[model samples]
Target chain A: MDTALSIGSAICLLLGSFLCLTGGIGILRFPDFYTRMHAVSVSETSAAGMILIGLMLQSPDGIVVIKLVMILLMVLFISPASSHALAQSAMRHGLKPWLSTTVPAIKNKHNETASDITSDKGVPPSNL
Target chain B: MIHTLYLSLTLAAFWLLNSGHYSPLILSLGAISIAFVVYLAHKMDVVDHEAQPVHLTLKLPGYYFWLTQQIILANISVVKHIWLGNKTITPTMTTVKSSQKTDMGKVIYANSITLTPGTIAVDLIGDQIIVHSLLSENIEALKAGEMDRRVRQLEH
Candidate 1:
């Protein structure tokens, strides 16, 4: 049982570290502020969650486990609130999201496929 | 009255968990601080249902479990797109109509949208949230309203 628990904790930690690394790469590679924020959000949510959960699993003390859970809850609640605030403020300041020129074509293709599916199902197309 | 009681309980629990030293002096200090803070909170008029959200305590765990699953899936997709590079990404912006009647519900919905990677809630005005997504399909998924429904369920 101890061995299994240790293995699970290790796996979670490793996965969390890997996700953090990818999120860092994403922050540097992605264009514009909003996409970069997405990268940060990715790291903030799952990576932190995984790491905290791993710690909780490894900790033998009840108080330590509760502390870790509290920290996890705080992160889960705060990260998104901060992200929303950042995005909202940035938007208010008129920072346009970078869009690819090819987006229209892909959007049209998606609409066509969606309409086709709806028509086949005998349902009217909802504004998508 | 119930909100104040819950707030004090939460604060007391938080203090106890953090301070392992069971000395009388430290315990008294913690008690005093907690009381002062709670008193200030009451004066500020923030100790209402919205602030405490005692009603959500029963339902939050299930919502959180579902949200965590969605977050994991979104992480995988966003990470895949990151490795796949720019040409594969289709950044799109769209407005999703939220059916949530309460401000708390709307906040939860917007936060859930932002919590999932590859999608960000850029702006929320009334019931319409302007979302920027890394992929158009993410926006499509938001439009499908599963998260909205879940958040609305939390409200009740």
Candidate 2:
């Protein structure tokens, strides 16, 4: 059981590290700032979450698991929020969307429907 | 009715689990602590119709599992781009009008959005939520309204 648990824990940690590494790669490789944000946000949350769960599983005592869970709760609470704030700041600062390679009749595909682009109302959509 | 009690019970269990040991004295102390916290929250008038759980059950595990999968896929996508070694991260921001009515609903929606990779909620103003994305593609995904639809389903 201990060996099985250790194996599980190791797998989780490896996956978590992989997630982080990929997120960084995404941040560096994505064509635009927005794309990078997508990578970082997704990878960070999952990697952290999986690693914690793995650690919790490996713990012999219930107390450690509970404490680890509390930590998980904290991650669930804060990381996304901070990411959201960062994205909002970037947009408010006038970051532009990337142009697509596909040459459709109408450029700025995002602008077709007001609702399709931005929320119901905020800033007008920038042409893609 | 049962759900609220269950939540309270869960909280109590968490407190006990974290505290360790199952002594009667400690159990009573934990109960008192939980009661005090709940009472204070109620006195603050934070408890209301929206405070109720809309989708309280085992299905939450499904959402968590799905979310984790999405995270993995997203991580892979991001990593691939990064390894390509081109400066491709483009940050884009936009406001989304939240369809959720209750405060808890909105909170859940916001939190869920954050949970997803590559998208972050900047600020939720009134009914509109401002979000930033690392990839403009993430914006396109959001425009698909998958997140909104799923989160709304979780709400009553």
Q: Write the per-residue lDDT of candidate 1 for residues A1-128, one digit (tens) a residue.
A: 99898999999999999999989999988877877888898899988988888888899889898889989989988998889888888877766666555445322232322222222221222321
Q: B37-122, model 1: which lDDT tens digit per residue?
A: 99999899999999999989999999989998999899999989888886787777666789999999998898889989999987
TM (chain A) per model: 0.79, 0.72
Q: How well is candidate 1 docked (DockQ)?
A: 0.35
**lDDT value, candidate 2, whole model:** 0.65
Clashes of 1: 0
Tens-digit lDDT track of model 2 for B15-64: 87787778999889888988887777667765544554545455567667
What iRMS does model 2 reach? 4.5
lDDT of 1 at B100: 96
Distance (Å) between predicted and true CA of A50, model 1? 1.5
Q: What DockQ class does candidate 1 belong to?
A: acceptable
lDDT of 2 by residue, A62-93 (tens): 77887998898888767777776675666557
- Model 2: residues >4 Å from true position, as ranges? A21-43, A85-128, B1-7, B52-59, B95-98, B101-103
- Cα lDDT computed for each candidate against the true fold: 0.83, 0.65
